[model samples]
Target chain A: MRGPYTLVHAEDNWQTDMGAWFSGERVVFRGKDLFTELNDFSWFKLLMFGITGKEFDDNQIKLFEAIWVLSTSYPEPRIWNNRVASLTGTARSTCVLATSAATAISEANIYGSQAELDAMYFLIQAKQAIDEGIELKSFVINHLKTFRRIGGFGRPIINHDERIAPLLNKAEELGLANGQYLKLALDVEKILLKERFRQILNVAGLAAALMADQKITLNEYHHYSVLAFSIGNISCYIDSSAQKEGRFFPLGCERLDYIGQEKRDW
Target chain B: MTKEKECITTNIWHEEAEADNPFAAKAAYCSGYDVYGELLGKVSWAEYIYLLFKLEKPQPWQSSLLESVAVAIANPGPRDLSVRAAMNGGVGGSTAASCLMAALAPGAGKNGGAREVYQVMRLWQQCGFELSQWQQHLANYQDEQAVEVWPASEHPPGFDPYGASCTTPVLQTLDHLTSLCPEEGALAYLSEHRQQLEKAADCPLAMTGVIAAAFTDLQMTEDQAEILFLLLRLPGAAAHALEQKKLGWRNYPFFGDGLTLTNDPGPAPKEDNLQGAL
Candidate 1:
């Protein structure tokens, strides 16, 4: 399938200051004792890059900024997952959708400085809005209750996300969104759903991704997709970790035997 | 609003408590729910019922709505939102919603985690040798102090304890696993690597390669394959991350750079090589 956006692959060592895409802007190291904190940030960056090929986008970066604010100034529990984890379906979904949408749209809109400037501006704005007390209509709720027949407030996995949309909608009104990427995202959503369903599009994942397209880089999207599915494995990891009293996946001689045996069965 | 907040918080706490059950809890599993196919393809009949009868996560009536959506999607006559949601992961909307978009696209390969195992296997095959030989060579290479390098004996360097190389359990497990592979070709590959494994025991990637190759030979579903991938890749990713974290490096210079074949460069690729079969 044709990627909705363009991917300009560059060779290693070219050292282009793709503007805000630069490492200094991308990698922020903040904590007490620069020497030790620098060590932790390097690891965190490695872990983050392994999960998502791209550097932390504006949302992640903004989250790190929050961490930095806490780290250097006040110090709090890692704020990124804190806020993200606390969010239920609609709000959480929208936050992910909106932020990922911004990154892709801004980058695709203009490469280099223009892209970086646009990305940073929108991100900084969204970060500020979240800091303020504004909340918007939950898009997940809107989609669930109205746009899609099966989505919304009553579903068991996501009961609390009803409040997210209002906050996001209010944020949109405050010019947190340029709206063009969202509009185009909707168009792509329509095309994808039409292909999936063999008719006009429904507000399904394809649509959500089209929405995500406006925010995340394709590689980032791939990471999101992988992580989403890996949620199942996360449960397994948690189970194994709990049993071991630490984070570990038990590897043993017998289990290894079972795996190898299965492979050669055919 | 206060009442609603209280209710939501109470419910969240209750759900968290109930999520403890591994077999029954719907709380542990998130639905990509389906509207047209199941609910828009977000929740499925089995899952909704699971939430109700098994998990009891929500109020019964409220949970029933999720099931109704699941049924609507799976109606089968026409592919509706319910069905689309069911079809989200695989077909008929039972698929996860996050996974739905990629599944809809033709070229977005179906295998995700299972393919990682296959990749490690492909890499192993690329560096040709029989699985048995590979196991022995690495075991000897790693635990040289523990045992003789390559006499045709039951106990080898990797078999005994006290090898400077830490992953002895991993190598032994792979050796046992290689014996189980169905194809003789794979067995032959194992035979070729026995000696080389003795020479370079320190290579974690090679050790990983042995474990990965052995695991790939087993029959597994896409989900199972994914579980294995995470299990194996975690060590490598963690090691890379750890180095950068501890060393305070600019990047994971060790990883992203191509892996070098330490033992033999192996022979020229032939038509019968496992790489061609894949």
Candidate 2:
């Protein structure tokens, strides 16, 4: 049967300012000669420059890089993205494929950087509500009712996330910790604890507060968080190189129980 | 006093209720018919899906094809990124939403998932209902080399990565399903020219290719095709996540045989790099 709509032709006029290739001479990244001018810059600085269309000072670069370093050490393959990376290695895939697969799978609701963006958004809204004479406890309760699960708080497997203290410490060391958002996050944590929730602000929450202080948009914050966790994913993939193909954990299969129909005639 | 409020404005708007009961609400109306009244038990889920998207119920063969497609791509095993992500999240004691998030993320990529399938469907459509036309277009595009039609990649979409022959079952399933349908549309064309296409591409017809062809034949939009693929895979991902949760938290290192603490502190930064960066 013929389709209802007929194909139409139009002149292609697509354009992009992100990056471009001009034959074999040199690549242009964000309107700058990548090989010539940007070669001396650090990868983090380059990434920031690419995203924000602005250059950063050494201190700023260090601060951002430190955030990445602090956040990139979750090498436990049980983390979703890390598991993808490890499985990629077991499949004997290339580093690019491994990292790509892992990164692709990192865009999750809670376990991924999206939680940071959501936390940032919520904190902003909470701050607004507080300014408008809403009680903090009531605001928290309302947020819980609306969102159900609070982003960037109450990590699994532990009552407190150890990374939060170090991250806050690092932010303090960098002289970038004295932000209202961080205070609000801490206050929210205090309220939750008072209410007997046992929820502490995790690294994502801390990062959200820091990013809010820096006036970073949710989009940029999410992207940066992904970049921060990328090394962990890549490292997990590399570490699993010693394992045989399709053997992530030897006992993983043993743990699985066949609960389906027992021996049936086809 | 009565003329003082002539410029009054109201903010709320209302639509007349269709159902007899004032408390009841109608969420969907299918093909000018009440969904609850006409479609609830009458149509299969696959047919309902098609009806919801295309505004018409699918043919028996189309619904059958969709059912088979869902069954075929449902579980790509635990090694698939979606399943692996769900399992990992489950092992970490994450909620079902987190697991589902991980499960959905990999569907956006070009590897054995919806994104690649959507692209292949578009490419098939662009080929314009003929095998020779597709071959000619490919040849011309290759010869020109001035503009890249597909994304800049070493391997094109609809082809598997090297050393991975994982799409066999998917293709076989597609073949079995298409055999039940009449010899027409994109599926028949693809099946007839499968050997040539594979020979030209230097790769077998991947699962994405078959799915693309099937979806195109069904006249589904790219977005609909992707959503269908994800919906089909959702149950499998949920199963994997629940199973992994049952297995409890995995404490062993991803690489070597060592039981690491769940809350193990991160490694100290290397002094040299720290100093350099600082």
Candidate 3:
């Protein structure tokens, strides 16, 4: 798909990483089904794309379902045991933040926030408008004008993002979404713009909105959102770990002071 | 492939002074003769195939062929469509297995499953904790301290179906891999967001964060981690079973008293062997 050079690479990177993971012995267990693994990997692959600022695809949603089934294979004892351990670190903390963001934003979408829960309302409205095959651009423009009087890819981080449009494009072709869906997302973006922090219509919100617009069902959206966010978090964690290591030496501290004794004469 | 040939004089190679384990048996066969001295070498996959069918050491290629078929036989049933497609499409069994293991989360959120260890590790890393810190934190919550025990209780608030406790041998290997990861940008990203990560708690994002941390700690190239997770758990388990003689190859049943049980299943795929698989 065309639009945004970054999304293409993000998608490719995700697929390549996922393919490599899929081909490795690490993911495979002897007494299990192969498809479940592929499906799980695909879901995480899309999630990684979202992390890198790409859009979600419906095929990714199917993969999410497949992941759920595979995930269910473990016994309760094992699940709880593993999860408790997983929940203890900085990783768990970040997951909390990401989920909290999602929960808060979704709540704002459903309920009006002082700044702009209206954009979420608009998203639902836009979904209805698009369902009737209305001109999405007009509806979005009206909302954008009313929300913040901004338009197009010149506004904020959303516009600056390297991967947005292509994700929307792929979503459109998968029969899972359309351009108008993004317009509604733009509406949300405009609302986020009104916030103190220049919030962008993140991949999560847009994905949730798109899935919602396609009438994918709330439960499904919840499921996909959790899985996608979790998968995205995997990439985020990797990024974070790298960051942690790098911080051991600040920019100016590249070389240590030669304070210790000089070498003795040979 | 099923029936066993009764008797044959084949040269056996014994690398070990004594056959104590599966690897020792394999070494013995590879070394060219047993203590009693018998010819054990075969030249081709076909010849080795005949030998294995006759309960002898098949040549390496023949072993590979048999392993491939055995892998095929071990794949999930056709009812699991995605797995069938993956296997048919030529994805290796070990890789597929790890992904499946990670993906094996329950919908109801009420039972135990593969705890997303890689994901958990990833999150821990993201949040600014060292692997040791994360492992310590996880250990505090676990009921058991065994090397391979499950890390938490069942029905964790947000569970990863692919996790075991932090004590897995793979964790050590992951440390090795982490030291080798090439990308520096990802590291910068983590540092930039460490505070934000550290502040999160008990949410879905946190769960993802933890899983991601594990992945990062493992220095898992996504595919490599996926494959390793899959094969590591089950293969290790299988190897243990074989060593315990809970399962046996050929007519030497686990419960049988008179069987020779001389056949070796070879080395279980350890981290190095798994890396080779990659």
Candidate 4:
């Protein structure tokens, strides 16, 4: 509803494609009963339905959930995002804030949602280019030259991504491994392996290809994946909250490599 | 074990370890300036914030300019989506971090939030004071689609496409910020040629535009502007959230009849057939 605006677009009522609460009567979710009809649907399934306005099979839902359950739940507070959660907990801060800060940090460029989204877009575009008869090798090189970094590649600190094999095994187990995007991804890996040994298919690359194969639009993927790191992050928050204050890997002051202006008189 | 962690870090923060406890900070410094010993109580928040980003103390005018922009962004009120999100967290008995995260989630949007300011700051980097370049850039904005990660701005980054007019606050901010800058500064250019910029973009000037120009005048990196925009505006969200926490959700401006929910499981708003519903 329009709160304070004189613009023409300001309307009296806002429309939602999703279902609504009938006060004390019942709840609706995408034309289905939140209680009666879809009560048995898993949370991930419900979340996906709400995000994309479409129902997914249990197998698909399981695969999606497994991606988070297996891979994202690092539980290590040293990860930048999780570190915030740990700090919040150690500070005796609330879980909500810890999760919030952690999630916010998860929006980091290199290893977060933006990277995944960028990689997904690049994969989509790269696929189209492949279809258009652009040589995959040249397209890959040109993309590297233009973007400075390829979206789906680059797993820092480690030469290989440990997550890819498990993800592939899981996908194969679910019979969802046969995707063209995944194929394209492996083909790109072929080039990277030959040319740049260190650059390998990261989880972002694999996940992007899999989601692309699932035909999950960028917007849909974004909404569904916002809570991607919540499990591990929230765990750190709660666990550290129970520990001695500020004791989650407490750091000595000597660790800071301050490279700013030297201390001076005011 | 559910999960497990570690770390020490920062360029902007340093601590001299007490002789007894190395883990405990005996003295804190922000950008090599002593925090408690020197800068605190002496330096205004605007000056300190400026120092934090620019890594140097700002001149009086620069500090004043920064303060003016910070004041403008400090409280966007409840109607602003970010503040509303914060209020929701406050009223709902949510954690302060959650509340701030809620605010930041929307505040990071490309529409009228920090991201908008960031893009405009970048536009400033690209166009500077050349109205012709701005006009040309807005006209040929599609060129940004090439290597840029964020969505290529379809409209000019700073101006609000939905705003009907250049609002009073935006105009006032432009006026005030212009007063703080040199005659040849970015704010000065914006103040002088806002109409031309507006006509080129076909939208009214917004606070974001003013902040972008002022940030440009302050010589802040676009990345810094983006984060600072979110941070400076948090005071309002946080204050409102605290206020709303006291007032409770009942008084927290619910849009009754404003939300028309579709696909009701029980029945439509007009109909009342309830067979399989809970």
Best by TM-score: 4
DockQ of each: 0.01, 0.02, 0.01, 0.51
Candidate 3 per-residue lDDT over residues A1-266, each given as its tens digit: 22235444443232222221223433322222234533454645545343332334557555334333332222221122223223322233443443333322322222112112233344666678878997766665566566553222232323454334555666655655654555567665664466433556544445445544555444334334343223333334333444543332122211222232222211
Lowest lDDT 10-residue stretch of candidate 2 chain B:
B7-16
- Ordered by TM-score, highest first, the candidates read 4, 2, 1, 3
- The sequence of per-residue lDDT tens digits that candidate 2 reaches over residues A1-266 is 11112111111322456665555556667667777668999988898887777787776677677767786567888788888889878878666667866786676665665566667877888889999999999999777877676777888677767777777788888888998998999999999889877778887788788878877766667667665667888888988877667668643222223332222111
Q: How big is the positional error of residue A218 in model 3, measured in Å on the Cα after superposition?
A: 4.8
Q: Rank the candidates by lDDT, best first.
A: 4, 2, 3, 1
Candidate 4 residues A111-201, lDDT tens each? Answer: 8888888778888888889899999989988888876788878876777778888988998899888999999998888897787645688
**What is candidate 2's fraction of native contacts?**
0.00
Q: For model 1 chain B, where is the 10-residue window of minimal lDDT?
A: B6-15
lDDT tens readout by residue for model 1, B1-278:
35421121111111111244432323222222222333325554544444423333344433443333233222222122222222233322221322332222211111222232344454344444544545545444332222111122222222222233435544454455455454554333543554455344333332334434443343233344334443323322223223334444333232233322232222323476676778
Clashing pairs in 2: none
RMSD in Å for all candidates? 24.7, 20.3, 26.8, 4.3
Model 4: reference contacts kept, as a fraction: 0.62
Interface RMSD of each: 25.6, 26.4, 32.5, 4.4
B186-226 per-residue lDDT for model 2 (tens digits):
77777778777665555566777787778887888888887
Please report how far candidate 4 places residue A82 from its true position, in Å: 1.9
lDDT for residue B27 in candidate 2, whole number 0-100? 39
Best by lDDT: 4
Native contacts matched by each model: 0.00, 0.00, 0.00, 0.62
Worst 10 residues of 4 chain B by lDDT: B142-151
